[model samples]
Target: MPPHDHHHPILATQGLSHRFKPSGRGLHDITLSIPRGQFVVLAGPNGSGKSTLLRHFNGLLTPRAGTVWLDGVPVAADPARARRMVGLVFQDAESQIVGETVRDDIAFGPENLCWSCDAVDAAVRAAMDQLGLTHLADESPHLLSGGERRRLAIAGVLAMGPEVVMLDEPFANLDYPGIREVLRQVVAMHGQGRTILLAAHDLEKVVGHAQRLIIMDKGRIAADGPVVDVLPLVEQYDVRLPCQARLGMSVTSWLN
Candidate 1:
């Protein structure tokens, strides 16, 4: 189906660009509008600035020249407020774990926002229960399996209850089951109306799940549109499209 006429965007980047070294792989003139309740994937090969760009949406990194907006308000205008609305889950679970126990770690986000004890406790229980990690609530993150840690890291974000969730390579080193577990949690979240923005080098999981696709090359917005418009970027850039999407291509009218 084509996009409906919704005017409000939960996340928008205007002419966003960044560079570490001139002409190196960094974002440039990248503009995007992600509407609420949509699952969008930022797809590209490695070094495409997908992670860097993901950082901008949540205020971890601000554009040197352009603007990042959240819910119609420029993100730079109020970094604190913007951060509260958006949650960024880094690809590595080790990068996110900080507390001594799972429960405490999951409570970190809400606690940082000064949430009340009762609210934080309720959030901790609800997030753990939602992810089926209620039993791991007291264990150290180091003791967790890679898949469990990934889920726990995300649970930390869920405890905060942000409006938009940005995942940077959620399945980076996952085995088959770990990948499936991550995908299942993401899909479940999507069903509940949370805006999902994923940066996946592994595009297979995104083929049928993401409603919008953005392909970045070097630092530029190479392509932006529905999956129908952007899927060929895989071939154009000599990258492989997921098998499912490729299979659909033979009879998929919307594809090129």
Candidate 2:
């Protein structure tokens, strides 16, 4: 059965723990609840388990000793439903493009989910239009610019009709204009009332747009709260506070 939208927390974790072999680095007792429509930024230095935690939300990686819940149901009980609810955009945009053209790429997810051909076309068209990729619908993914490629990746996820959108380092290695373009798209998605959880080491690029900030260190959640309340402690966790916050100025949107 499809999980209802009435669940208090759209996503949650309890005592979650996962340790990689040999290195023994992973999440430790992560417990948190994310309300629907919340915009959260998960920040931390490398190896802080941000990626690992996101994976658990969608059942990509099973928990070693904990539980993940989506829409009030155990994710382990219904991984397929969990994945349908949570759309994850990985750090690498290039690696996500499987189709030859932009339109084909966006339709991939819905097609795999067994949607009818008309439904797939509608979803692909809607995603491309929302991501501003309509003009490039026929273009090859290989020829897209950095910003275009990132948007394509996101469009593919959007085509899946997910309720929660999680992006891992959405803005990496892009020039200033590219960053702005991608940031705008992310903000627009959040505006549509979908829950958004973005994981990035650099907070300055996105801190302003987030309602809550979560900082992780050494595979544990070091801090989590409203962006204002968490900014002060971010540096201690190795994630730099935005320059505006450091100067006692309000963190303004990157869109400006």
Candidate 3:
């Protein structure tokens, strides 16, 4: 990891706002900051601009009203650099998979970054091992199970060695076991000290693992605070609270 100023946030948005011309589906005046090495979850109901706000983190969408800063530099000013530092794993794993085999897919990002063959190979191996995909190295990505495909998408991003990782709806279509597998990997990644931001509608799967939770509603921020503080208000924003939380029980580990 490159040395970063501890005084400044790793990522931030200042009065950021955007709207799709046709549908008017976008964020509005979203001002937030994420410190280095923090694990945060951006939670909201469907179409609440969670995805749109995340797109601005790495310059995927330019702000129409305010500014997005990455390491104190405007993301729009150096998009290439910003993207290299912030990696995104889309909700649909299939759309992002390009290589025929798992190893090839993970190597794609490093190759695009102009890394040497030896470096790319090493990165590919490390990412597979990190995500427990080493045994599936030669297997076709399309043939993998839902959990495996999600892990593959994450592996691809991990190979790029990005400073910040943002995952959108990582547990969307998975079964219980699949969700557990992905959750374990996400927890492990945070353990490794990489700043992480996960976007999801439910707090059931990842709330306990995240330190902070930011709730989005109707294209604006409704709440931003520690997970415990935000979980109680999830229902007010149209997001489902974890069953345990609803039952008045303590939120336990999803993996357990």
Candidate 4:
């Protein structure tokens, strides 16, 4: 892993709040700071505002009551710049796949940035290699397996070269092997010094990889701290505590 920079937060939220019409399914008074190169996991049950909060990080959802800052600049000031700095991969990878081929999909972001042909090609190749998708470069994204599609979605975001990457429910709908593959890629990204923020309900799948674990309940932050210290109480907030933690064993691997 690269050196950590403690000077300023890469992403910060100050009393951030939002609400959806009729249902009001959104975040409330969320205040937090994520430093550069930190692998953070935002865990919670369904409807806990994990997705909503992740959207706010990149201006996908506007803050109805508070503010979000990206590298000390308000996200509201320049939503486009903030989005460029932070990339989000939705839980349903198929929803984000636009191009017919995997290579074309991965190249979309860089193309939009108006990168030179060589630069776009380089980025696409690098991202595909990173996600183990080079073999499937010519395949149709829609025809890929669940895990392959998920990796393609992540590769698309990585091609844009964002500083921070947020994935919402990345492990959902995947088999054990698929889960492991995604977990491995996530760890590799963190090793490259990219700040990682993944939201998921399955703590056992990612708690071992996270430096900090945050629990959310009813669209609010319930707990935030080191994974070890906070894992014990995760069950109290309706999120499951890793079985190993409950059995008095160390959480050393997600595969376990």
Q: Which pairs of residues collide in model 1? A: 26-219
Each prediction's RMSD over C-alphas, in Å, is 4.6, 1.4, 0.9, 2.0
Worst 10 residues of 3 by lDDT: 1-10
Candidate 1 lDDT: 0.83
Ranking of predictions according to TM-score: 3, 2, 4, 1
lDDT of 3 by residue, 47-126 (tens): 99999988998889999999999989999999988888999999999999999999999999999999999999999999
| Model 1 per-residue lDDT tens digits across residues 1-256 | 1132356688888888887766556778888888899999888888888899988888888787788888888888888876777888898889898979999999999999898999999999999998889999889999999999999999999888888889999989888787778788888888888899999876776557888888877878788888877886666754568776677742221111
Pick out the ten consecutive residues of candidate 1 with the lowest summed lDDT.
Answer: 247-256
lDDT of each: 0.83, 0.92, 0.93, 0.90
lDDT of 2 by residue, 1-256 (tens): 2445774699999999999999999999999999988999999999999999999998899999989999888999999988888999999999989999999999999998999999999999999999899999999999999999999999999999999999999999899999998999899999988899999999999998999999999999899999889999988988887888889999998888
**lDDT for model 3, on a 0 to 1 scale?**
0.93
lDDT of 1 at 204: 71
Instruction: Write down the TM-score for model 1.
Output: 0.91
lDDT of 4 at 67: 92
Winner on lDDT between 2 and 3 is 3
Task: Score every model by TM-score.
Answer: 0.91, 0.97, 0.98, 0.96
Q: Encode model 4's per-residue lDDT on 1-256: one tens digit a residue.
A: 1233567798999999999989978888999999898999998889999999988889877899889988888898898887777999999999999999999999999899898999999999999999999999999987999999999999999999988999999999999899999999899889988999999898988888899999999999999999888898888988887788888998877655
> By descending lDDT, how would the candidates be arranged?
3, 2, 4, 1
Per model, state how many residue pairs clash.
1, 0, 0, 0
Clashing pairs in 2: none
Pick the winner on lDDT between candidates 3 and 4: 3
